[model samples]
Target: MAPAIRVEIEKKHIDEAIERARTGVSKEESYYYGDRLTSGLQLRVQGRQAFWALKYYNFTKTIGYAYPAEDKHLPSVSAARKLAAACKDILDDDPKMLEPMLVKYYGGADRDVKKAKKEMVAVSTGWTVEETAEAMIAARTKPDTDDPIKKSTVAQFRLTLRRPQVKALSKKPIADVTKADLDAVKREMEKSPEGASMIKKFVSDIRSILTWGATHATDMTSLDPSNIWWELVKSGKKKRAITRSPIVDDIVKTLILAESYLERPLPGRFSEGKFGVGHNVLNALWWLALSAQRTTAGTRLRLVDFFPDPKRLGSGWYLAFWAEGETKNGKAFVLPVPPRAAGFLQERMAKAKRNGDSQWCFPSSQARGKIEIDIPVDRNSPGGVTERMAVRDYPTKDKIAKELAKNAKWESPYVDLLAENDIMYWSPHDVRRTIVEVLEEHGIPGGASAVLAHEVRLTDDLLFVDNARNREQYLELRVSRVTKLAYGAGGFIPLKSKAMEVWTNTLIDRYEELHSTYRQARKKAQAERVLKAIYSDANSAAEAKEAAYLELPKIRRKLEDNLTGHKQMLSGLLKKTPPPDAGVRTARIEIELAQADLDAFNTDPASYAIEPSRRAASRTHSAVLQSALKTDEKPVDLVVEAPAYTQLRDQFIADKIDVHTFRLLITERYPITLDMMDDRIITGMVTGDEAL
Candidate 1:
């Protein structure tokens, strides 16, 4: 018996090994004929026979047993070498080539050859961009379920990524898809610049699909379309507009008008009368704004997710809603619901209690028919989300915005009624921007990111254990006071004092003022038309007086109705002894002015018919100060003591109040701007004009 040895295969070595095998000198061991171009090809010798075999990576089994010296069918050493070299070339140049050769030489009985042949076919034909993408999609398995991918994601991919324009690229072999192919797809999509985002997402989805297929299917080539987006970006061909936040006044007016529209069914749609769907939309918008959670989180919000008991964590009735892993980031977290957002949820809960459907916090009408499944059968079971019910559950953020746009008449009355306004419509996500902007205006640093739950680059101080302890202490000691200011609990303003009321009143005032112009114009026009009819007929004076009597009250009543309705709303909001600085004073004054104009018009409709003269003096302010020392124009005489200023400085540092608010408070007795107060005033620094 001889010890098995691994040696480089040469003609000399093969001949010596064959001679030893025939004489039974090394019959117990096999001789490996190693090929530099290929792996696992060997000449096994046992007794007086030798077999050509392979134990390569793909073909992990030995095949073809023949005695080269005795059998007429077996090839000579030179022929065997040539055959091995051909197999090596087949493996390199064409994997499919090995399939037919394996079937011919090794036969179908060879397991490794059968497996390798199957894989070779998949790699050759099934690795086209389209086929590989499909394969990757099919192979995906989600946790705790048999769903390959989310239905919504599948629909999105089909709509955006699998467009007809990409069909040609999809047909190309995955490896053969060049930058040119991707650029062509980009150009095709770029024709509709609105879909610039879709093209970017298409590139990402394709890259992800191909990468997954390459690793998992063992049949696809590496495909990365990331460069396509970069190329488009570098070329400055990509066109995506930045969406601005909706003005806060527009948001409030939209909600109010939407509520009005809800009172009556939509002009053409909304068959179910007063289903509170308008309130649902308004509530959803408010929730998105105040909570700063994405629409998906708001839609899937459940009644069970709320922790109403104020006893826990001293949160004082905060909604500790839990978002699932299905969020934008695959992370589950508990979001602290602000008071305004919680108010919306509480309203929904109250409605649910009245009507026994309390499963979803913000359920759609379709949810009424949905019954919860105690036991799950599949992804489409009763417990699973349904497409029909997804408008409010797993809803698109733009759903509310689109609905508002579709019902534009709901907001049209408030759209351009004020100061040459153009605030027509806005998306629900704009609410997030609105909140962030308002907080920014109030000088709350990093509050926007904190509210939105966006990831921020943490500094060493933020990560320090001592800083963590300080945060814990603040939360524990000042949670109630801070929550009032930040969350607007118990009539506390989340913004500047009476900001929401001022905006609401301004919207109402503008609408009423516009109505007043239309009313006076219509009345005058109607009177002229009536007088013309009388004059053409050559009627008596009694006829003209009769027409006036018939028309004037109706016009007056319409204008008065608007003013009366607004007055009622304002009167409710107005405190009996409102603080002089309170915004309610302005709303009260507006109502009084509107009421006075209405009464004066009723007394003399003919005189009121004339349009008022425009005052050029009021249009622009004069650069020179008035020579008269008017009491209203006089600077405030009150002086802030050093101790009070020092206290204000400490309060600003403690975050008890913002710098702007502190300035407003100190200058409340005076007609002073926030700009006039300056940081120096807050820090008690002596100005050249002031004594410290």
Candidate 2:
């Protein structure tokens, strides 16, 4: 060990020198030096500096230092004495002896240096590096404040004052903190349990402040206060987790029940004054909630975005709105009204029109002019006023969200209603989630990401190809598939079957009418043939009979002419006188010849003079009869006019035939098969001569 040394001071002199030191003299001339001399001991300075000098004797040794500058400069004598006593107590140790003198000298210009040195002594007695580390971690994990920094800053100011907390905390000394000191602070916080959280947060804030100072402060030698705190304290307890709101089925039921309340009548003044505005105000709120839109760049919607009616696009009305502000994305956005939303708008428009509010669909009652009220009424305002209105102002987006929070117990009322009913929700952006879900359920290709408008994850080939063209092709394929399912082959089954039934009945009726007409024509032709045959037979018989009659007349005339010529001969013979028997014999011979000629004409028309003409008429009648008989030949009738064989043959030639009955059979029982037919063929079936 080192040699022992001793020194002492006289009470009066020590006090006088202390007074001088308090008056701001240099430490060499202060009470501490006088104490060494007064002790009547040999003084050997271990260090040359006056403040750091050590006095020693054969018996003892001691270091001496002056009071701190701040304490020395104080006017109070008592305060100076107390500071001197503190300095004297510190002189026993190596660090203690130099620290106070250093603090006295540097404290005015460098208070942190003095404080750090003091804390170093405190940490040596009480804290460890491990404890400091723990405190730092706890600080980092602590909850942040509502306003961590100013809302906004100018560029120049941002550069100068950025991370101010970090700069401030980094300069703090950590060695001074003790574990007991940290525990005491925690105990105090627990004493007021309500403020415990706040205390913990303060500790955390301090730690973060120190960390920032370490990283950003101009001085690098200072201990990080945050690190010191961590070593002094364990991590604070974590906060309990909060539960999210449940999207229960009861919420859906509640909304449905509330829908009727939307249509309830307002308190009416009846014959005295106008109705209470509550009903209208509430109803409009409901409508606005139902019509939630993105109101951002992706889907910017305005008053003009709506079509009045879905069913009648051309006949229905439409609304257009001009937006004033930019969208959330910093880009302009415009949203089109889908069919269903348009229909809803149209119905509302008609109601408003009936109320004589034709000029404005949703007018602002407090607007300065017609142009000001051009947009849809803000839902939160009474009497359709805006937020800036002098009377009833509209609620802001935050206010609206707060109000909705009270009612938003379900996923979304609009989404539930629209999706469940098959009328897709197209307005609110979250409804897109519902849409994508539905598309996925249907197994439509590319539906999942497409509905969400996500970037496509494409193969190399697809990426090289034009995405737009591929998208079009994909859409067309989807359309074709849907069409196939809807139409079920020849045509849409439901409509096509009904149409075919009507067409078959009509064609059958027409066939019956035509058959009746054809039968009549056949009968007429048969009658004409019968008449010609009868006429031929009658003419042949008549011609033979007329020839016999004509033959008799011609024969009689010839006999009479012969008799007249023989009369002259007979007169000459009579004058010459002749026998009576001889005259009678000649007359009998002439009568027999005349009778023979008549018999020959009757036996055969060809034997007489008129026979040739009769034979020619008979031949002509026979030819006419044969020609009419041939013309009247009839085809064999069958039960079925168009046979299966003929139909099959026709089907091959035409690819398919509208076998009236066959089409009906296929439509009802084999609809799927019909769906497989080529689209071109199906189209041809519709335009062809076959029954529909």
Candidate 3:
């Protein structure tokens, strides 16, 4: 036997012990230093190495190493003191709890201790790990807070605990579960073909249960929730891959539109057993896609929770509520959806009220005909709505997974579902992600966070805070919490509404209105230019113009044929087209666009057309008059530049024109009639930009 002594368990004492351990010691010998600071912890300083162990119930077990800070494998002096304290408490109150723990760490004891263990096991048996987990699950069913554990979570938790490797460990006494056993469970999870994300969730769920059981379960009283040795078991460092594929927005719109057109035949090839899923199922899925809400709270939405005229806000828009604890963020959210989504929801709610359906807007209806009233959707809960929707519209491999209770529950492939829409293997969760990404891409940033009802930890907020001091806008984005402190929840409505509008607009396969608007703008500008060309054209002075000159004004006398005639035609069309239509709007835009062209035409003296027969004679007479009137002036170049440019500098000095008009005359190289000058200045002023 080696010598044993008591000493303060500090770094200095440990360093001294390490020195003694390395020097003046035989390789075969070992020394034991009992911790003076803690009751059960001791330092085993051997010739080759040192260890931290706990002595309790006639057996001592090596828990960790003692030197070189144990290469992060073992706790340091401060952490070891805390662990030693916990061990002291466990040993003083329930030493047997540490018995299996020691056996697991140090392996089987000598024959005498093993025989004693048999007797000890017979008397002090506790609940198995499986029992502790079940108890934890049962406690979860009765929620302690408003934020209750989801049924799907509990179900998934059950599935993870029941795995073969986990099962074998779970069957053992809770106290016997060693670091190695937990590590083995992690390896088994890693072997699963379900991929890293699923494996990650499995480890996380099991870890939560283990932690909850340590504090909550009766048989797991002695275990520390925070200090469980399973903390060493990691889910690996691999980042989870994005499993669901991105869908084209136009394809998504087509899918939504197809729902109204495609008749999902009942008792079809995809519909396996019972009649088939009804419209309610599809509606729930659509709501998820439109709202970007989780399946649980979204599918369970009651009609009353939807406020069509919140605070008497408006008719076309709406405000929706999900109570606190219902959402993943655990905050009550008042959401606003697009007009189309709101319209559909209102129509459904109105129909439900007429049908005397209790609360759920979408009731159970598996029949091919009209749905039955007074119950929720075909499923009582939101648990398998995604899977059922996938099966009916899109097929999934989930039915083959052993975790699900049913073996392919009521299989059906309603032909007009997601597959017919070309996104066959769809995830409703990814649908939420898809829309959020679209909104972020299209400049409505808040819609991304607001869709999932997420907290505002976005990079937008960071930029806002960072740029606030610089007094510069870092982003031209959506109205988020940073911009809406005074408006509160109501402010998000319009922002989210705009986001949905942008999303829906993007979803349109052919944006005819947008194209029409662009084309109209181009034609308006082009029409004005064409009119100017016609006004100045030599061929426009008709033989008929000289006859009409008897009763005409001088400007009208010069406007012999083309633009003057086209203006008459434009006026005629404006009279024939009905008011408030695209035709009237188009006529008005063209007329407005031609204002400057007409004014500039009338202002320039040379733009006037002359009678065709005498045009050469009239120009020769004008040239003779100008030559006779010249006095000591040099001959000028044939300048086509507008006369306004030569006089605007003097006009500006005299305060006869403001900055914009000055720029317009100098830069645009043109002038307008007095009547249109104000409008021209206002429109032209927008161009006065300078580099800082």
How well is each residue in 37-152 modelled by candidate 1, as lDDT tens digits?
Answer: 44566766767666666654565333444455443233445545555555666667775566456545443343343354444432345477777776656655444322257655
Candidate 1: Cα lDDT at 578? 60
TM-score of each: 0.28, 0.21, 0.32
lDDT of 2 by residue, 464-500 (tens): 1224557567544433332333233322233322322
Total clashes in model 2, counting residue pairs 3 or more apart in sequence or in different chains = 30
Whichever of 2 and 3 has more lDDT, that candidate is 3
Whole-model Cα lDDT of every candidate shown, in order: 0.47, 0.36, 0.52
What TM-score, to 2 decimals, does candidate 3 have? Answer: 0.32
Give me the displacement of residue 106 in model 2, in angstroms.
5.2
Q: Looking at candidate 1, what is the lDDT of residue 59?
A: 58
- Cα lDDT for residue 524, candidate 2: 50
Backbone collision count in every prediction?
0, 30, 6
Give the TM-score (vs. native) of candidate 2: 0.21
User: lDDT score, residue 585, model 1?
Assistant: 69
Predictions ranked by TM-score, top down?
A: 3, 1, 2
lDDT of 3 by residue, 56-115 (tens): 668676656765343323435665666555555556766655554333333434323333
